[model samples]
Target: MHILLVGAGLSGAVIARKLAEAGHRATVIDGRDHIAGNCHTERDPETGVMVHRYGPHIFHTDDEEVWDYVQGFMRFMPYKNRVKTTSQGAVYSLPVNLHTINQFYGRTMRPDEARAFIEEQADTSIEEPQTFEEQALRFVGPDLYEAFFKGYTEKQWGCSPTELPASILKRLPLRFNYDDNYFSHRFQGMPEHGYTEMVSRILDHPGIEVHLQTWFDPAAAGEYDHVFYSGALDGYFGYALGRLGYRTLDFKRFTYDGDYQGCAVMNYGDRQVPYTRITEHKHFSPWETHEKSTCYEEYSRACTPEDEPFYPIRLVDEKALLADYIARAEETEGVTFVGRLGTYRYLDMDRTIREALDTVAAYLSDTAQGRAPRAFYQPPMG
Candidate 1:
């Protein structure tokens, strides 16, 4: 069967490659001049540092199969995300670990002692937290929440913490140990050559034809046997209902002669700072020594049609709008919505690749059984 993939990002590349290996032809198209979507990376002409065109993306996942699958493409260097936050004119380790807790309170409490101390500070009265602010206060107390999460969260999402759902805060880790690794995933690393190189390798298949600067019109879906669209859900429908909310990022690029922040990511937890974090690209590839460094001061705001959408803002109103889009997608035939944007959710790289692989697998199975492919592997909302 001849399949059309709408985006040349991780999802499109992974799906196209898998479909091609399964003896099906896939034509991949992207609106951008380059492939790899937001994960696109290139060497700075002056600094000679690998720059993440969008933002820093560290590959970390517990899925062994997904990890092995990526290894088949490019080599991954050992990299752990030890994120630090600048709050109230001081630098502290992220995830509010034992080190941060001790330093913040001026008490070198042990693991158990720190755990007890945080518990004492927690608002035990709030049996069930509803908002991001409530979750933080209940778990880490007001002081840590205000100093670390409050300002940053407000700046990142462009809203008050109280307006955000509690589930967003649940993803964050509050540890009593000194382990400062940003993610608790078993495997954490970055592509040695960069994500763009890795994704390009994934799309290199005899059965696949890639077309850059090409936009696939939804009306042209009839030309192919099936369409695996990784573009925005509302976009496919021409935004007949409404545009789903998204928080887009603007990167302010700068060059530093020496080591910038001594870390890959240094988040500013003060709302007054404006930008969310500063990412030093050279630190992303620690093995490669470069005298110069390239950094991005990332600013997040409400996404407009002109901006590149990064984070999906699935607040109450957006969720309602998303439901309308999802319904429309379900009614549409011969097209499957896949990936973060298509599904209207914020997905990690590992989840995106894994879902793409599974989507193709399900398509093959459905075809074998003479069944229609599903519009979505899972619901957009939980």
Candidate 2:
């Protein structure tokens, strides 16, 4: 079988490798000049630091199989995402942990004491929270919400908390203990070489042919037996329905002679600050050291047609438009949507790889049974 992969990112690379191993010829194409998509990394010629070109991508996953799969391609160095935020003229730990609570209030309280004290501050009157603001007020009270989440959320999403859904805040951890690690996953690390090199190795199979800076026309789908698209879902249809909402980031790069914030990521929680967060790239690869450091001041805004989409904004209006696009995708044939952009959802790297592997397995199984594979492995909507 000849398979056409639309994007050369993690999803397309994983799927292409798996299919190539099964003795199928795979051709991978990407509009961008790079192969790794948003996770592309390169060395800073001046600083000799491994820079995450898109942003800081920390690989964290509890799935043992996924962790081992990545290790087969490149060595992973142990890394933990300890994050901090600047708010109200003071720096504090993230996720509103016990230490953050004590520091923000200027009081030393044990876990139990802090828990009880926060309960008193919470607005119990709202039994069920519907919006982001209501969820924060119900969980951590008004002061913490204003200090940590309000301004940051507003800037990141370009909307007031009252307009966003409560589910947005549900995934965040509000720890009673002092552990400040952002993610709770068991396996967390960085690829020793870089994401581009890791993905380059993944696509090294003899059966796979990669063409960079290639624009795949939908009319060319008939050239291959099957098409696996990792590009934008709406883009596959030429946005005939409507463009889905997304939040794209603008990274302003700056170089510092010494360590800037003494951490990997420093988020500014005050809305007065134009940018949302500043990331020190050298800190991402702590095993390697250099006298000079490179950083990015990240700014988020509504995505336009010319900008590269980052975070999907699945608000009510966008959901309605997405439903129309999904219907159009189902009506179309011979092409299967895969990855975050294809499904129009925000997904971590581990989940993207897992889904790609599962998608290929299902595709192969269906072909063996003489049945057409599904348009989607799983519904995009949860």
Candidate 3:
């Protein structure tokens, strides 16, 4: 079988490798020059520090299979993401932990006391919270929300919290304990050689041919037995219906003599701050020693056609447009949609890999059973 894998990100690389290993000829194409997509990383020529080109992507996953799978490609150094935030004039730990709660209120309350205090501050009247604002108010109350989330949410999403979904804030944990680890996953680490090299290893099979800096022509899909698309769903259809909303990021990079922020990620909770967070690339790989550091001040805004789409803003209008695209995709033959852009969802690295693995398994299984594979392994509509 000749398989066409579009977008050389994790989704494409993983599926391509799987197909190639199964004795299928796989051709992988990416619009970008690199292989890792948003997770692309490179060593700075000046500082010799491994810099995450898009942003810091800490590989944290609870799935043992996915963790062990990535380890097969590259050595992963154990890394914990301890994020810091600046609000008003003071600095504090993220996820609104016990220490943050105590410091913000100017009291050394224990876990139980702090929990009770937050409950008292919370608006119990709101039974079922609908939006991000209501969810925060119900969970952490106004004072904590204003200090930690309000300004930061506005800057990050470019909209009022009231307009955003409650699921967004639900993902963020508010702990009464002092544990500041951002993710509560069993496996948390980063590739020692950076993501680009790791992905290169995944696509190293002889049956796989990689075409970088190449645009995939949809008309050429007939040449292959199957097409796995990880590109934007609307883009596959030439945006006939309308462009789905997305939030893109811009990085203002600068090199520092020594430690710049002293942390991997620092969030600016005050709306006065233009950029949402500043990432010191050196800090991401703490095991590596470097005299100088490279950092990026990240700014998030509405994605333009020219800009790279980062986060999909699944507003009501966008969802409607996405449904139309999904319908069209279902009717289209010989192509299966995969990954974040294809599904129009904000997915973590683990979810992306897990889906890709499952997609390939399904494809192989269907072929063995002499049945046609579906357009999507995981449907976009939940």
For each candidate, how many residue pairs have backbone atoms clashing (under 3 Å)?
A: 0, 0, 0
Ten consecutive residues with minimal summed lDDT in candidate 2?
Answer: 373-382
RMSD of each: 0.8, 0.7, 0.7
Which parts of model 2 have CA positions greater than 4 angstroms off?
Answer: none
lDDT of 1 by residue, 1-382 (tens): 9999999999999999999999999999999999999889999999999989999989999999999999999989999999999999899999889999999999989999999999999999989999999999999999999999999999999889999999999999989898999999999899999999999999999999999999878899999999999999999999899799999999999998899899999999988999999999999999899999999999999999988999999999999999888888999999999998999999999999888888889889999999999899857985
Poorest 10 consecutive residues of model 3 by lDDT? 373-382
Mark the regions of model 3 whose C-alpha exceeds 4 Å error after superposition: none
Q: Please give each candidate's TM-score.
A: 0.99, 0.99, 0.99
Using lDDT, give the best candidate's number.
2
- What is the clash count of model 3? 0
- Model 1 local distance difference test score: 0.93
Candidate 1, TM-score vs. the true structure? 0.99
- In model 3, residue pairs whose N, Cα or C atoms come closer than 3 Å (at least 3 residues apart or on different chains), thus clashing, are none
- What C-alpha lDDT values do all the predictions have? 0.93, 0.95, 0.94
Which pairs of residues clash in candidate 2, taking residues 3 or more apart in a chain or in different chains?
none
